[model samples]
Target: AQTVTQSQPEMSVQEAETVTLSCTYDTSESDYYLFWYKQPPSRQMILVIRQEAYKQQNATENRFSVNFQKAAKSFSLKISDSQLGDAAMYFCAYKTILAGGGADGLTFGKGTHLIIQP
Candidate 1:
């Protein structure tokens, strides 16, 4: 079974400061995909960033980026400049790389709670 792991249950960061959320996963397949999703108070899980297993370069979007270590199965998210709006529950997810694999949806980790400090 493929499992995603988020070591940090809670983390706080001051405004404008950077913070990194740790994540890891266990997967036997080589071509799987990894993702970091942010769930705000609205409870909508929004995709922050994603890294394909085959991509050597890390994935990034605006202030959000990921450190993807394929061999170690580590995929951590980095927030360049923290904001109050960034406070939310972050979930690490993974899915098979096949065409219909997404039909079953992604397997998500327990999630990490992010708190923005003034």
Candidate 2:
């Protein structure tokens, strides 16, 4: 079975600071996809970043970035100059090579609740 692991359950950073959340997964397939999703208190699932297993370079989206170590099966998210708006529950999700062929859904980790300090 493919499983995503979020080592940190909770994290906090002051306004304007930076923080990184760790994630790792176990998969037998060589080709797959990984994602970091943000769910605010409103419970809306938002895509923060995504990385394809075949890509060697990391993925970045404005203030967000990822450190993807394919061999180590690690994918961590880095939030630079974190703002109050960054406060939310971050979830790491993975899609198997065989899943999501149009009718399947995504598999997600428990989640990392981020608290922004003033």
Using TM-score as the measure, which candidate wins? 1
TM of each candidate vs. truth: 0.94, 0.94
**Local error of candidate 1 at residue 91 (angstroms):** 0.3
What would the per-residue lDDT of candidate 2 be over residues 1-118, giving only the tens digit for each residue?
7888898999999999999999999988899889999999977899999999999999999999999999999999999999999999999999876653563367788899999998
In angstroms, how far off is 66's CA in candidate 1?
0.6
lDDT of 1 by residue, 27-50 (tens): 899897888999998778898888
Give candidate 1's whole-model lDDT. Answer: 0.92
What's the lDDT for residue 89 in model 2?
A: 98
Point out where model 2 deviates above 4 Å.
99-104
Candidate 2 has what TM-score? 0.94
Q: What is the lDDT of candidate 2?
A: 0.92
